[model samples]
Target: MAETVTPAVGDTPAPASTRRERTGWYVYDWANSAFQTTVITVFLGPFLTTVAELAAGCELGADSCAGYVYPLGIKVAAGSYYPYLISLSVFLTVFVLPVIGAVADRTTHKKRLLGAAAFTGAGATIAMAFVTGDRYLLGGALFLVANISFGAAIVVYNSFLPQLGGPDERDGISSRGWALGYLGGGLLLALNLAAITMLSEDDNPQRTLDLARWSIVSAGVWWAAFTLVPLRWLREHPTAAALAGGGGNVLTDGFRQLGRTLREIKAYPLTLFFLLAFLVYNDGIQTVITLASQYGTKELRLEQGNLIITILLVQFLAFGGALSLGALARRIGAWKTVLLSLVLWTAVIVAAFRLPAEAPLPFMALGAAIGLVLGGSQALSRSLFSQLIPTGKEGEYYGFYEISDKGTSWLGPLAFGLVFQLTNSYRVGLVSLLIFFVVGFLLLLAVPIRRAVVAAGNTPPRVL
Candidate 1:
């Protein structure tokens, strides 16, 4: 939510003064996305894999390591370390994210906490520059810290959505933030790629390694530096509910709040039901975003070079896509627009299942289609969800939102893998995901959105 909606309890009624702070909120998206695209989505895996392969005694640039390494008496594939570390981070984050969200609700310093999380994550990314000479463990350790902090930041950041504006404004605000994120992350990745290309002309192994490390460092710097905008301008948008005293240390209070939250959330069936719908569909969305490259490479026999280009295409186009979707939401309501996007998503999956091999142009067209609906769905999902949350529970509820989306997200991939294992058909594996879209869409329709919004004490948008 680029800013706010439904005018959080302490705010004036849709005042003009809030615009600057809202702009600052959008800048936060711009700042942090560098870390997301550069490190998480693109660079870190291959770099860490290279370093780990070296640690396992593989020659630089060799096709395979021909060995396994033991970490804590567990045998692991050298190429798997990066993904393993990411999974570990997400697993651990499943616990930490709720705590962060609960604390955000309890505290007046939500903005400060957002800052702290961003800086800590950025610091870890900066430290990644020293991950050299078979020190893949060090790199993994740093990323673990960074990834957890990133989740914390998102929870706190999302908590601000309700505090920023009114119902009619939220869809656009959230969509714009997402758009800036795409543009920012895309720009940074492009610049980093250009720098690496110029500096690594010879393709020397050590030079490439150093370039990769510095590129990560640059991403961290980008995150921290741009964060100053929000830190400087985003004022505390306090809730009307008084901050209740628990008479415990901050962490203890946070957990205490979380316990109460779990019990009380049952009162809001709308929130709970919306959350269920979000979890089901968002899982499918995340799976496609995660596995698209693998499907292109292994299933369609697309070139590695072409796959990279496709990723770039998705990143840049998603910016415009997000804005376009926001506009659509204003006209048709975010809920209905999202339902329409799901229809498109189902079509995209069916089309993907039938895409021909060695066809770069068709693959690019598919990517363009994915990019168009991707940002709109996510932005509006968050916008629509913000309405169902009760007053004073932004952090804790969004924590549930974040955790459900991130935690069980693996189910889609698991099902896809099982289908492929049984049928020996990548097309079947890919199309199997249609179940997630269909089921999630039906669940979403079952939500009774306006009734839920009214129950949650939120103003329904004009279109809705």
Candidate 2:
């Protein structure tokens, strides 16, 4: 059932006096990011590969035995299909998030929707424990559900930003949320890693497998536990009376509203341009996050412990970097800060391609550089987009924002996978990402920010 919120009558807005409540709301990121760090980005890929090989009836250390297997049904080169699976997941999210976002906007059930999505995601993540052997299908299925829920929940969460703050407070609030998320995510990831180390052996195959499963489960539990903060702290705004005119058919009306939004894009050119730029650059960023672990393990051949440590470093670094970039963005414009991030990303990708296999230190250095730029780029991008959205239509526009964020993500991974398949080289695949960075940077440079913000129905402030 949908939960209802009653907005306070007055000039100040619902979130104005609720500083402690807003802080609690921001903590949800910290609660949820553990899944991204430990399960999705770092540990899960390698762990799944190991599980697949075992399920294929292969013994450890046997020369002829399979060491890795694809979760997809493809028997010929399973590793190549992993990227495609990622693309497929993103494809599903692209179709689903906008509608969900629209529904939240028109309905009075934003918190209910968010809670449902969080539980769904967290449940799927926790269910990863039972996935073993040929159960790679089970793992993938759970991952698909969790990933979709996570993305959808984010839509609801982001929609709250406009409701929570006036224009003057939005960037700081958004940046603080990101920073807290990094800290929470990093802290939980550390605990999970410690549990794995204490409970399992480096060479004991069975125990190590158990440890991996535990790590995934911990992320789920952490996510569920931390989400309570936001669930309690954030309040949904009242649904408009106009949206209630359809009686019991409000959901249908919500869909109609979304269709209307799509038709109205011609009225907002800057929003259109920003969406395009966001789609392209965000794809590049996603590719980097998804592929870096595989690149470390398969291509660089770094030790597992070192790889884990590097990822941990990234979480902490990203926390610091996000705060730093927020400050930097205040000094130089947000657009320039974003441009700087793109330049750094291009250099990092190019450097990754050029790195020698024997020198793992360079790879670690590259990871740190990525950590510095990654959070800043994404956090600032979200804030920039927030500045462009209409006052009351944040949810509807952010629905489209999800489309831009996740829709063509397939392009980056598909490009990387295809390049790797054709050339049989990770270097070539790494180099290909440079194209996304360059193209996105060029396109972004051409966007007239002030005009775009105004066109999206935001009042044009003098400096921005």
Residue ranges of candidate 2 with Cα displaced over 4 Å: 1-17, 53-76, 239-247, 404-408
- TM-score for each model: 0.85, 0.90
Tens-digit per-residue lDDT, 1-464, candidate 2:
32222332234343443676577668878877877777777777767655555666667423223234544445523345556666777889777887887787777767888899989999999999889655767877887888788888888888888776655455566777888887877887788777766776766767766777888899999999989888887766744633455555656876887888788768888777877888888888888787777778767777566677778888889988998888887777678889899999998888888888756788788889988998888888887888788665677777767653522266787888788777767778888888889999998888899888767656543244
TM-score attained by model 2: 0.90
Candidate of highest lDDT: 1
C-alpha RMSD values across all candidates = 4.1, 4.3
How does candidate 1 fare on TM-score? 0.85
> What does the lDDT read for residue 355 in candidate 1?
92
